[model samples]
Target: MEIIIGPLILVAQVALNLFWWALVISAILSWLVAFNVINTSNQFVNSVGSFLYSITEPALRPIRRFVPPLGGLDMSFIVLLLIILFVQNVLARLQYSIG
Candidate 1:
């Protein structure tokens, strides 16, 4: 059990870390696009933006449904990040115990 569960927990922790960064990048990219700091007309910028949207939007949509944006600010991103952080911490504790 320890052999299998330990590796699985590690993988989950790594995935969560990647997801946490993805959310942060997506939020910053959205801001840049909104402010015209980065134009979607540029092929590279558009491609990255689209890719980020595709990946992050699914996770965010449900959160948005419940929380809704407040005063032109989206709190869903923050909420999602917090949830991810909590999960990561839980994984860490689990991994510690298993190992």
Candidate 2:
């Protein structure tokens, strides 16, 4: 049981780290789109944007509901990233305590 649980925790940590990168990528993509630096009509750009949206939207939507954007600058992404970091820290502490 210890062996199995240890590997599971490591996998979870990796997953959270990957998710953190995804959120960062999504935020940057959004900025590019907003600034018209990337053309959404292009198939590749559109597809990538869609993929990012699908991945990040589920987590961000709820946050958006309660915290509306201020002056057209959305802070929800930042807030979500911070939340993910906090969760990652807690998970790390749990793994340390267990081991």
Tens-digit lDDT string for candidate 2 (1-99): 767877888898898889889899988988999999998999998998899889889999999998999999888898998998898898888788888
- For candidate 2, the lDDT comes to 0.88
Writing each residue's lDDT as its tens digit, candidate 1 over 3-98 gives 899999889988888988989998999999999898999999889989989999999999999998899999999999999989989888988877
Runs with alpha carbons beyond 4 Å of true place in candidate 2: none
Q: In terms of lDDT, which candidate is strongest?
A: 1
- Model 1 clash count equals 0
- Model 1: lowest-lDDT 10 consecutive positions: 90-99
Best by TM-score: 1
Alpha carbon lDDT of each predicted model: 0.91, 0.88
39, model 2: CA deviation in Å?
0.4
* Pairs that collide, model 2: none
Which whole-number lDDT from 0 to 100 does residue 8 have in model 1?
91
